[model samples]
Target: MTTKANFPVTAGSIVVPYGHVIGNEKWRGSEIAQRLQGKIRLIFEDGLGLVDFHLSNRTCILYISEADLVAGDEFKRRLVRFRNARSLGGIVIVERTQISDQYFLAVQKLVVLELGMVLLPVANQGEASQLITQLVREQSKDHNSNPFLRKQCSQLAEPSLFRTVQQIPGVGKTKALLLLQQFGSIHRLCNASVKELELVVGQTVAQQIYSFLCS
Candidate 1:
Protein backbone atom coordinates (compact mmCIF):
# COMPACT_ATOMS: atom_id res chain seq x y z
CA MET A 1 0.00 0.00 0.00
CA THR A 2 2.07 2.90 -1.28
CA THR A 3 0.69 5.95 0.54
CA LYS A 4 0.59 9.57 -0.64
CA ALA A 5 3.67 10.03 1.54
CA ASN A 6 5.63 8.33 -1.20
CA PHE A 7 5.22 10.79 -4.02
CA PRO A 8 6.29 9.02 -7.20
CA VAL A 9 6.86 12.39 -8.79
CA THR A 10 10.02 13.00 -6.71
CA ALA A 11 11.91 9.74 -7.28
CA GLY A 12 13.77 7.04 -5.32
CA SER A 13 12.32 5.04 -2.37
CA ILE A 14 11.60 8.28 -0.43
CA VAL A 15 7.97 8.26 0.69
CA VAL A 16 7.41 11.38 2.75
CA PRO A 17 3.74 11.35 3.64
CA TYR A 18 2.07 14.74 3.21
CA GLY A 19 0.62 15.29 6.69
CA HIS A 20 2.36 12.73 8.87
CA VAL A 21 5.66 14.58 8.42
CA ILE A 22 4.73 16.88 11.28
CA GLY A 23 1.58 15.53 12.89
CA ASN A 24 1.28 14.20 16.46
CA GLU A 25 3.21 10.94 16.13
CA LYS A 26 6.53 9.93 17.63
CA TRP A 27 9.61 11.53 16.03
CA ARG A 28 11.03 7.99 16.06
CA GLY A 29 8.34 6.90 13.59
CA SER A 30 8.94 9.81 11.25
CA GLU A 31 12.71 9.25 11.39
CA ILE A 32 12.35 6.11 9.25
CA ALA A 33 10.11 7.83 6.72
CA GLN A 34 12.56 10.70 6.23
CA ARG A 35 15.32 8.37 5.02
CA LEU A 36 13.98 5.61 2.76
CA GLN A 37 11.65 7.68 0.59
CA GLY A 38 13.88 7.22 -2.45
CA LYS A 39 17.30 7.37 -4.11
CA ILE A 40 19.63 10.34 -3.72
CA ARG A 41 18.00 13.64 -4.77
CA LEU A 42 19.26 17.22 -4.48
CA ILE A 43 17.05 19.31 -2.16
CA PHE A 44 18.22 22.91 -2.00
CA GLU A 45 16.60 24.97 0.73
CA ASP A 46 16.72 28.05 -1.47
CA GLY A 47 16.10 26.12 -4.70
CA LEU A 48 13.49 23.64 -3.40
CA GLY A 49 10.76 24.32 -0.88
CA LEU A 50 7.41 22.99 0.41
CA VAL A 51 5.30 24.66 -2.24
CA ASP A 52 2.89 21.77 -2.62
CA PHE A 53 2.48 20.85 1.05
CA HIS A 54 -0.03 22.55 3.32
CA LEU A 55 -0.50 22.47 7.08
CA SER A 56 -3.23 20.30 8.62
CA ASN A 57 -4.93 19.92 12.01
CA ARG A 58 -3.98 16.25 12.23
CA THR A 59 -0.28 17.09 12.00
CA CYS A 60 1.91 15.60 14.75
CA ILE A 61 3.46 18.93 15.78
CA LEU A 62 -0.02 20.15 16.71
CA TYR A 63 -2.00 17.91 19.10
CA ILE A 64 0.86 16.33 21.04
CA SER A 65 1.30 17.50 24.65
CA GLU A 66 4.90 17.71 25.86
CA ALA A 67 3.99 15.99 29.13
CA ASP A 68 4.12 12.70 27.23
CA LEU A 69 6.03 14.05 24.21
CA VAL A 70 9.13 12.02 24.97
CA ALA A 71 11.01 11.90 21.67
CA GLY A 72 10.33 15.37 20.32
CA ASP A 73 10.85 17.06 23.69
CA GLU A 74 14.11 15.25 24.28
CA PHE A 75 15.51 16.06 20.83
CA LYS A 76 14.72 19.77 21.17
CA ARG A 77 16.02 19.91 24.74
CA ARG A 78 19.29 18.23 23.81
CA LEU A 79 19.68 20.61 20.87
CA VAL A 80 19.21 23.61 23.17
CA ARG A 81 21.73 22.25 25.63
CA PHE A 82 24.15 21.53 22.81
CA ARG A 83 23.81 25.10 21.59
CA ASN A 84 24.50 26.58 25.05
CA ALA A 85 27.03 24.02 26.23
CA ARG A 86 30.18 24.98 24.27
CA SER A 87 31.67 27.95 22.44
CA LEU A 88 31.63 26.13 19.11
CA GLY A 89 27.97 25.68 18.09
CA GLY A 90 26.38 22.38 17.06
CA ILE A 91 26.47 21.19 13.45
CA VAL A 92 22.87 20.86 12.35
CA ILE A 93 22.62 19.39 8.83
CA VAL A 94 19.11 20.31 7.71
CA GLU A 95 18.56 18.23 4.60
CA ARG A 96 16.35 19.34 1.79
CA THR A 97 15.07 15.75 1.75
CA GLN A 98 13.63 13.86 4.67
CA ILE A 99 16.11 12.02 6.93
CA SER A 100 16.16 8.26 7.43
CA ASP A 101 16.82 6.32 10.64
CA GLN A 102 20.16 4.91 9.51
CA TYR A 103 21.56 8.32 8.62
CA PHE A 104 20.26 9.88 11.83
CA LEU A 105 21.95 7.17 13.92
CA ALA A 106 25.15 7.66 11.94
CA VAL A 107 25.00 11.44 12.52
CA GLN A 108 24.39 10.93 16.23
CA LYS A 109 27.69 9.06 16.31
CA LEU A 110 29.65 11.56 14.22
CA VAL A 111 31.72 14.24 16.01
CA VAL A 112 28.56 16.37 16.13
CA LEU A 113 29.37 20.09 16.24
CA GLU A 114 27.68 22.33 18.76
CA LEU A 115 25.89 24.26 16.02
CA GLY A 116 24.87 22.12 13.07
CA MET A 117 22.48 22.27 10.16
CA VAL A 118 19.07 20.50 9.96
CA LEU A 119 18.19 17.70 7.53
CA LEU A 120 14.92 16.94 5.78
CA PRO A 121 15.11 13.38 7.18
CA VAL A 122 13.35 12.05 4.04
CA ALA A 123 13.67 13.51 0.57
CA ASN A 124 16.63 14.70 -1.50
CA GLN A 125 19.22 13.32 0.88
CA GLY A 126 22.80 14.07 -0.08
CA GLU A 127 26.26 14.33 1.49
CA ALA A 128 25.71 18.03 2.22
CA SER A 129 28.44 18.70 4.78
CA GLN A 130 30.87 16.60 2.83
CA LEU A 131 29.93 18.46 -0.34
CA ILE A 132 30.25 21.82 1.38
CA THR A 133 33.65 20.96 2.79
CA GLN A 134 34.73 19.66 -0.58
CA LEU A 135 33.72 22.94 -2.14
CA VAL A 136 35.60 24.84 0.55
CA ARG A 137 38.70 22.77 0.02
CA GLU A 138 38.51 23.38 -3.71
CA GLN A 139 38.11 27.09 -3.18
CA SER A 140 41.09 27.11 -0.82
CA LYS A 141 43.29 26.54 -3.92
CA ASP A 142 42.76 30.19 -4.95
CA HIS A 143 43.64 31.66 -1.52
CA ASN A 144 42.78 35.10 -2.88
CA SER A 145 39.05 35.22 -2.29
CA ASN A 146 37.77 34.73 1.27
CA PRO A 147 37.38 31.05 2.11
CA PHE A 148 33.72 30.04 1.65
CA LEU A 149 33.49 28.69 5.22
CA ARG A 150 35.93 30.97 7.09
CA LYS A 151 33.75 32.33 9.81
CA GLN A 152 35.68 33.97 12.64
CA CYS A 153 36.31 30.78 14.60
CA SER A 154 35.47 32.76 17.67
CA GLN A 155 32.72 32.59 20.29
CA LEU A 156 29.10 33.52 19.53
CA ALA A 157 29.71 36.94 20.95
CA GLU A 158 27.80 39.98 22.03
CA PRO A 159 29.34 42.84 20.07
CA SER A 160 32.26 44.55 21.80
CA LEU A 161 30.56 47.86 20.95
CA PHE A 162 27.90 46.91 23.46
CA ARG A 163 30.59 47.02 26.07
CA THR A 164 30.93 50.69 25.13
CA VAL A 165 27.16 51.27 25.29
CA GLN A 166 26.89 49.66 28.73
CA GLN A 167 29.52 52.05 29.97
CA ILE A 168 27.38 55.02 28.89
CA PRO A 169 25.26 56.66 31.57
CA GLY A 170 21.65 55.46 32.19
CA VAL A 171 21.75 52.41 29.84
CA GLY A 172 20.62 49.21 31.62
CA LYS A 173 19.95 45.51 30.91
CA THR A 174 16.29 45.88 29.85
CA LYS A 175 17.13 48.60 27.34
CA ALA A 176 20.13 46.64 26.05
CA LEU A 177 18.17 43.45 25.41
CA LEU A 178 15.33 45.38 23.79
CA LEU A 179 17.67 47.41 21.59
CA LEU A 180 19.64 44.34 20.53
CA GLN A 181 16.48 42.47 19.57
CA GLN A 182 15.08 45.38 17.56
CA PHE A 183 18.20 46.41 15.65
CA GLY A 184 19.78 42.89 15.84
CA SER A 185 23.24 43.76 17.23
CA ILE A 186 25.41 46.59 18.50
CA HIS A 187 26.93 47.23 15.09
CA ARG A 188 23.45 47.87 13.71
CA LEU A 189 22.42 49.97 16.69
CA CYS A 190 25.61 51.94 16.35
CA ASN A 191 24.38 53.18 12.98
CA ALA A 192 20.83 53.95 14.16
CA SER A 193 19.70 57.45 15.17
CA VAL A 194 17.93 58.55 18.30
CA LYS A 195 14.64 58.43 16.40
CA GLU A 196 15.10 54.74 15.47
CA LEU A 197 15.93 53.86 19.03
CA GLU A 198 12.84 55.78 20.13
CA LEU A 199 10.75 53.79 17.73
CA VAL A 200 11.96 50.63 19.46
CA VAL A 201 12.28 51.78 23.06
CA GLY A 202 10.73 55.26 23.47
CA GLN A 203 11.51 58.92 22.88
CA THR A 204 13.23 59.46 26.20
CA VAL A 205 15.24 56.25 26.12
CA ALA A 206 16.06 56.79 22.49
CA GLN A 207 17.67 60.09 23.41
CA GLN A 208 19.77 58.32 25.98
CA ILE A 209 20.78 55.56 23.56
CA TYR A 210 21.55 58.04 20.82
CA SER A 211 23.63 60.22 23.08
CA PHE A 212 25.39 57.15 24.37
CA LEU A 213 26.16 55.36 21.10
CA CYS A 214 26.89 58.67 19.37
CA SER A 215 29.71 59.25 21.79
Candidate 2:
Protein backbone atom coordinates (compact mmCIF):
# COMPACT_ATOMS: atom_id res chain seq x y z
CA MET A 1 0.00 0.00 0.00
CA THR A 2 2.95 2.33 0.50
CA THR A 3 4.44 4.30 -2.38
CA LYS A 4 8.12 4.26 -3.40
CA ALA A 5 8.50 7.61 -1.66
CA ASN A 6 8.43 5.73 1.63
CA PHE A 7 11.66 3.91 0.67
CA PRO A 8 14.78 5.30 2.34
CA VAL A 9 16.93 5.07 -0.80
CA THR A 10 16.23 7.30 -3.80
CA ALA A 11 16.27 5.27 -7.05
CA GLY A 12 17.50 8.28 -9.00
CA SER A 13 20.40 8.90 -6.67
CA ILE A 14 21.47 5.27 -6.26
CA VAL A 15 24.34 4.38 -8.58
CA VAL A 16 24.97 0.64 -9.10
CA PRO A 17 28.54 0.16 -10.22
CA TYR A 18 29.04 -1.81 -13.43
CA GLY A 19 28.65 -5.59 -12.90
CA HIS A 20 27.29 -5.10 -9.39
CA VAL A 21 23.77 -5.66 -8.01
CA ILE A 22 22.43 -4.06 -4.86
CA GLY A 23 20.28 -6.54 -2.98
CA ASN A 24 17.79 -6.07 -0.17
CA GLU A 25 19.28 -6.97 3.21
CA LYS A 26 16.55 -9.61 3.55
CA TRP A 27 18.31 -11.66 0.84
CA ARG A 28 21.57 -11.78 2.74
CA GLY A 29 23.14 -15.28 2.60
CA SER A 30 20.04 -16.47 0.75
CA GLU A 31 20.08 -18.82 -2.22
CA ILE A 32 19.97 -16.04 -4.78
CA ALA A 33 22.64 -13.99 -3.07
CA GLN A 34 24.84 -17.02 -2.57
CA ARG A 35 24.46 -18.10 -6.20
CA LEU A 36 25.25 -14.61 -7.45
CA GLN A 37 28.44 -14.21 -5.38
CA GLY A 38 30.93 -15.42 -8.00
CA LYS A 39 29.09 -14.24 -11.13
CA ILE A 40 28.45 -10.65 -10.11
CA ARG A 41 29.31 -8.49 -7.14
CA LEU A 42 26.40 -8.39 -4.71
CA ILE A 43 26.07 -5.55 -2.27
CA PHE A 44 23.56 -5.82 0.56
CA GLU A 45 21.71 -2.71 1.62
CA ASP A 46 18.94 -1.69 4.00
CA GLY A 47 15.76 0.34 3.30
CA LEU A 48 15.26 -0.84 -0.30
CA GLY A 49 11.62 -1.26 0.80
CA LEU A 50 9.49 -3.04 -1.84
CA VAL A 51 12.38 -3.64 -4.23
CA ASP A 52 14.22 -6.95 -3.77
CA PHE A 53 17.17 -6.08 -6.00
CA HIS A 54 18.53 -3.06 -7.82
CA LEU A 55 20.01 -4.01 -11.21
CA SER A 56 20.78 -0.42 -12.03
CA ASN A 57 19.64 3.09 -11.16
CA ARG A 58 16.75 2.86 -13.64
CA THR A 59 15.90 -0.84 -13.21
CA CYS A 60 14.97 -2.95 -10.20
CA ILE A 61 13.69 -6.47 -9.53
CA LEU A 62 10.89 -7.75 -7.30
CA TYR A 63 10.86 -11.39 -6.29
CA ILE A 64 7.51 -13.17 -5.88
CA SER A 65 7.68 -16.57 -4.21
CA GLU A 66 5.24 -19.47 -4.66
CA ALA A 67 4.05 -18.73 -1.14
CA ASP A 68 3.28 -15.15 -2.11
CA LEU A 69 1.18 -16.35 -5.04
CA VAL A 70 -0.73 -18.83 -2.87
CA ALA A 71 -1.19 -16.38 -0.01
CA GLY A 72 -3.37 -13.96 -2.01
CA ASP A 73 -3.54 -10.53 -3.75
CA GLU A 74 -0.82 -8.89 -1.68
CA PHE A 75 1.83 -9.42 -4.39
CA LYS A 76 -0.42 -7.90 -7.03
CA ARG A 77 -1.00 -4.88 -4.82
CA ARG A 78 2.74 -4.53 -4.29
CA LEU A 79 3.37 -4.61 -8.05
CA VAL A 80 0.63 -2.04 -8.64
CA ARG A 81 1.96 0.22 -5.92
CA PHE A 82 5.48 0.06 -7.40
CA ARG A 83 4.10 0.73 -10.90
CA ASN A 84 2.01 3.66 -9.69
CA ALA A 85 5.02 5.07 -7.92
CA ARG A 86 7.03 4.90 -11.19
CA SER A 87 10.31 4.93 -9.30
CA LEU A 88 12.11 2.60 -11.72
CA GLY A 89 11.61 -0.01 -14.42
CA GLY A 90 10.42 -3.10 -12.52
CA ILE A 91 11.33 -6.61 -13.68
CA VAL A 92 9.29 -9.04 -11.62
CA ILE A 93 11.04 -12.35 -10.93
CA VAL A 94 8.31 -14.78 -9.95
CA GLU A 95 8.71 -18.36 -8.76
CA ARG A 96 6.69 -20.58 -11.08
CA THR A 97 6.48 -24.09 -9.72
CA GLN A 98 3.61 -26.51 -10.43
CA ILE A 99 1.51 -24.87 -7.74
CA SER A 100 2.19 -21.34 -8.99
CA ASP A 101 1.59 -22.36 -12.62
CA GLN A 102 -2.14 -21.94 -12.10
CA TYR A 103 -1.66 -18.26 -11.27
CA PHE A 104 0.89 -17.58 -14.08
CA LEU A 105 -1.49 -16.37 -16.78
CA ALA A 106 -3.33 -13.97 -14.51
CA VAL A 107 -0.07 -12.60 -13.13
CA GLN A 108 1.35 -12.30 -16.66
CA LYS A 109 -1.70 -10.35 -17.83
CA LEU A 110 -1.59 -8.04 -14.85
CA VAL A 111 2.17 -7.41 -14.91
CA VAL A 112 2.76 -7.24 -18.68
CA LEU A 113 -0.56 -6.07 -20.13
CA GLU A 114 -2.28 -4.12 -17.40
CA LEU A 115 0.68 -2.57 -15.59
CA GLY A 116 3.25 -2.66 -18.46
CA MET A 117 6.01 -4.04 -16.26
CA VAL A 118 8.42 -6.83 -17.22
CA LEU A 119 7.59 -10.29 -15.83
CA LEU A 120 10.19 -13.09 -15.75
CA PRO A 121 9.26 -16.47 -14.30
CA VAL A 122 11.90 -18.67 -12.70
CA ALA A 123 11.80 -22.16 -11.27
CA ASN A 124 13.43 -20.97 -8.07
CA GLN A 125 15.94 -18.57 -6.53
CA GLY A 126 18.84 -20.39 -8.24
CA GLU A 127 17.43 -19.72 -11.70
CA ALA A 128 16.60 -16.20 -10.65
CA SER A 129 20.24 -15.67 -9.76
CA GLN A 130 21.37 -16.89 -13.19
CA LEU A 131 18.92 -14.53 -14.90
CA ILE A 132 20.09 -11.68 -12.69
CA THR A 133 23.67 -12.37 -13.70
CA GLN A 134 22.80 -12.18 -17.39
CA LEU A 135 20.82 -8.98 -16.86
CA VAL A 136 23.73 -7.43 -15.01
CA ARG A 137 26.14 -8.40 -17.79
CA GLU A 138 23.76 -6.94 -20.40
CA GLN A 139 23.50 -3.72 -18.43
CA SER A 140 27.27 -3.47 -18.23
CA LYS A 141 27.58 -3.77 -22.03
CA ASP A 142 27.88 -0.63 -24.15
CA HIS A 143 24.64 0.61 -25.68
CA ASN A 144 26.05 0.50 -29.21
CA SER A 145 26.86 -3.18 -28.81
CA ASN A 146 23.19 -4.11 -28.36
CA PRO A 147 21.83 -5.92 -31.43
CA PHE A 148 18.50 -4.07 -31.31
CA LEU A 149 20.16 -0.68 -31.23
CA ARG A 150 22.54 -1.68 -34.01
CA LYS A 151 19.66 -2.88 -36.20
CA GLN A 152 17.61 0.26 -35.59
CA CYS A 153 20.56 2.48 -36.46
CA SER A 154 21.42 0.53 -39.63
CA GLN A 155 17.90 0.28 -41.11
CA LEU A 156 16.98 2.53 -44.07
CA ALA A 157 13.28 3.49 -44.22
CA GLU A 158 13.20 4.09 -47.98
CA PRO A 159 13.01 0.42 -49.06
CA SER A 160 10.18 -0.39 -46.68
CA LEU A 161 8.29 2.75 -47.70
CA PHE A 162 8.42 1.79 -51.39
CA ARG A 163 7.34 -1.78 -50.64
CA THR A 164 4.36 -0.58 -48.59
CA VAL A 165 3.15 1.84 -51.26
CA GLN A 166 3.40 -0.84 -53.96
CA GLN A 167 1.12 -3.11 -51.90
CA ILE A 168 -1.91 -0.91 -52.74
CA PRO A 169 -4.18 -2.23 -55.50
CA GLY A 170 -3.01 -1.37 -59.04
CA VAL A 171 0.04 0.56 -57.77
CA GLY A 172 3.36 -0.37 -59.45
CA LYS A 173 6.87 1.04 -59.44
CA THR A 174 6.02 4.08 -61.61
CA LYS A 175 2.92 5.06 -59.66
CA ALA A 176 4.69 4.39 -56.41
CA LEU A 177 7.58 6.62 -57.51
CA LEU A 178 5.18 9.41 -58.55
CA LEU A 179 3.33 9.13 -55.22
CA LEU A 180 6.58 9.21 -53.27
CA GLN A 181 7.80 12.23 -55.23
CA GLN A 182 4.58 14.14 -54.55
CA PHE A 183 3.83 13.07 -50.98
CA GLY A 184 7.39 12.12 -49.76
CA SER A 185 6.06 9.58 -47.22
CA ILE A 186 3.29 7.02 -46.67
CA HIS A 187 1.70 9.11 -43.90
CA ARG A 188 1.22 12.12 -46.18
CA LEU A 189 0.07 9.93 -49.10
CA CYS A 190 -2.50 8.18 -46.93
CA ASN A 191 -3.96 11.50 -45.82
CA ALA A 192 -4.12 12.99 -49.36
CA SER A 193 -7.59 13.74 -50.68
CA VAL A 194 -8.72 12.22 -54.01
CA LYS A 195 -8.46 15.66 -55.62
CA GLU A 196 -4.90 16.07 -54.36
CA LEU A 197 -3.85 12.56 -55.49
CA GLU A 198 -5.39 13.19 -58.94
CA LEU A 199 -2.66 15.77 -59.71
CA VAL A 200 -0.10 12.93 -59.74
CA VAL A 201 -1.98 9.76 -60.85
CA GLY A 202 -5.23 10.74 -62.66
CA GLN A 203 -8.75 10.78 -61.21
CA THR A 204 -9.62 7.06 -61.48
CA VAL A 205 -6.34 5.82 -60.02
CA ALA A 206 -6.54 8.55 -57.38
CA GLN A 207 -9.97 7.37 -56.26
CA GLN A 208 -8.75 3.76 -56.22
CA ILE A 209 -5.74 4.72 -54.15
CA TYR A 210 -7.87 6.75 -51.76
CA SER A 211 -10.35 3.91 -51.33
CA PHE A 212 -7.65 1.31 -50.89
CA LEU A 213 -5.84 3.38 -48.32
CA CYS A 214 -8.88 4.61 -46.44
CA SER A 215 -10.82 1.37 -46.48
| Top-TM-score candidate index | 2
- lDDT assessment of candidate 2: 0.74
Query: TM-scores, in order shown?
Result: 0.26, 0.64
> Per-residue lDDT of 1-215 in model 2, one digit per residue for the tens?
10112223664446766566888889987898888877877887777778999887777889999999999999999999889876577778889999999998788667654675556778999999898887777666666664223221212223334544675677888897888778766557767999999999998899988887665
Can you write out model 1's per-residue Cα lDDT over 24-126, one digit (the tens) per residue? 1222224323442342221211111111111211110111112212344444454455445432222233332222343443333221222232212222223
- Report RMSD (Å) for each prediction in the order shown: 17.2, 12.5
Give the runs in model 2 whose Cα sits over 4 Å from its true position: 1-8, 11-13, 150-215
lDDT of each: 0.35, 0.74
* Maximum-lDDT candidate: 2
Model 2, residue pairs in steric clash: none
* Residue 24's lDDT in candidate 1: 16
